[model samples]
Every structure is written in structure tokens, then in C-alpha cells.
Target: GAGVSQTPSNKVTEKGKYVELRCDPISGHTALYWYRQSLGQGPEFLIYFQGTGAADDSGLPNDRFFAVRPEGSVSTLKIQRTERGDSAVYLCASSRGGFGHEQFFGPGTRLTVL
Candidate 1:
């Protein structure tokens, strides 16, 4: 792959609903990240995966949010009990190195909780 790619570019759901956002990273990239961007704000780191384990998940607001990279290439962000405040663009990125390295971002998945 050329870069990160996100699926279901847009999503609409009722409050309390659950959603899953997917990310496909470039081949051979071992560092992956997930971020959430609210209106008028920059992307906020949500989680980071180094290989198949989550290296940092402190950015996740609460237990309602989680992500996984099982094969170290593709990842999925899972949100539970979605709230209206959760409406935002979910972005995925990948780099060849760990933190501090340049990241290639994917076109985000816009999620709306109505």
C-alpha cells in the first residue's frame, strides 16, 4: 500500500450505538497510531501500537475506546456507547520508526453520533 487508508469515510449513528473504524497501513510499517480530531481542534492521540501490542493507550478518553493491531499491519478502533461528543474525525497514521518519527496520515473516518 502507498499509505494509510481508512474505511467508511463517514458514519452516522444514534447515541449508545457502537462503531468500528478500520485502518490499513503501508506494508512493513510497524508503528501505528490512532487519533481523534474534534472541530476547531488538532488531532489528539488516542492510541499507539508497536507491532502487535498497544504501546500507549493513555490517550484514550476512557474504557469505552479501544484499538487493536493483531497482525501488525491492519488495525481497528472500537468505540462503545458512542456519545454525541464522540462525533469527530478519526485518523490513522503509521511510521517506520517509533515515537518522534514522521507519520503518514490516512484520510480520516468522520463519525457522527446523533
Candidate 2:
């Protein structure tokens, strides 16, 4: 892809259901990140991957959330037992490498748990 692309720009679901969102980063980029933004709040970092390894998964809220970048390219975020509290914008970003790099963000996947 020419830029970061996120799937399902908007989603509405009942509590306890599962959802999966996808992201395709710019070609040749080696770093990917996931963040959650609630209304009026800044984006909160959830996870980051470098190549095929997750360099940081410390920010994942719980076991119900997981992400994978198997080929160091496209990635998917899976949420289980969704709750009302999970309603927010799921943002995906990618950078050349390292924390200091400028991250390019997608339009984001907005999940609404009703």
C-alpha cells in the first residue's frame, strides 16, 4: 500500500462479541503500532512490532486484545468479549524504525459497543 490502511473504518457491535480489524502498512516499513483513543483523550499506545517480533506489547489492556504482524507487513488486531468500554478509535501506525521516527497513522477503525 502507498500508506497505512485500516479496515472497517466503523464498526458497531453488542457487548461480548468479537471483532477484528486489519492494517496494511507502507511497503518496506519495519515498525507497526496500535493505539486506542477514547473521545477527548489522546491516543494511548497499545502495542508495537518490529519486523516479525513484537518489540512492545506492554500496553495491551488485557488478554482479550491481541495483535500480530506475521510477515512484517500487514497486521490484525483481535478483540474478544468486547465491552462498552472498548468503544473507541483503533489507530494503526507505521514508521521506518525506532521510537523517534515519525509515525504515519491510518484513518482508524472506530468500534462502537452497544
Candidate 3:
């Protein structure tokens, strides 16, 4: 009964470098979400996956950012040609697989692009 987990609690990379952030949701949770949080802003929703496919990804900043949940459990956020502005805390959360369900959040991955 482990909660959500994110790898590489912290990451530092040069600008324009590609990086991947991983997330493992709680067991049996079918709903997963990705969010980004800046210094003063609240966590901004990035994408949501229901099962093995992305159900909503309207918040993705651009094509440079992408995410996948191939088996409906673990997910990876891929950032390509990263920019300094991409620095932020990337959070992952999961729920019982529906709207209004309480979501469990991970500690998040702090990404710093120099």
C-alpha cells in the first residue's frame, strides 16, 4: 500500500537538455495526473490519464513536453529541448479513477534548468 512516488527527487540540467521524470501511482488507482508548480503559483495541471491513454492533456505547455502511461500505472514525463523557464516542481497524483475523487500526491520532482 505504497503511495505515489517520483524518482530523482531533484534534477539539475543545462538548458536545452532532454530529461525524463518518472512517477509511480498508488496501486489500483486508475486515474493519474501531472502538474507543474512554479515559485509562487499553485500546481498547474498538465495532463491526466485514465487507464493506458491520456484522457486530457490540455495543460501541456507545448509539444516539447509529453507524457505517457503505457500500462495504466506508471508514467513518465518527457521534456525535450528544455528551457530555463521549464524549472519547476513536477508533481504526480492519482485517484480512484474518476472526477471528484480525492487524489494522492507524490513528493514531486524538482527540476532546475540552468
On lDDT, the candidate that comes out on top is 3
Q: After superposing candidate 1, which stretches have Cα over 4 Å from the reference? A: none
Model 2 residue runs over 4 Å out of place are none
lDDT of each: 0.94, 0.95, 0.97
- Clashing pairs for model 3 are none
Higher-scoring candidate on lDDT, 2 or 3: 3
lDDT of 3: 0.97
lDDT of 3 by residue, 1-114 (tens): 799999989999999899999999999999999999999999999999999999999999999999999999999999999999999999999999768999999999999999
Model 3 bad stretches (over 4 Å): none
Give each model a TM-score: 0.96, 0.96, 0.98
Q: Is candidate 2 or candidate 3 better by TM-score?
A: 3
> On a 0 to 100 scale, what is the lDDT of residue 73 in model 2?
95
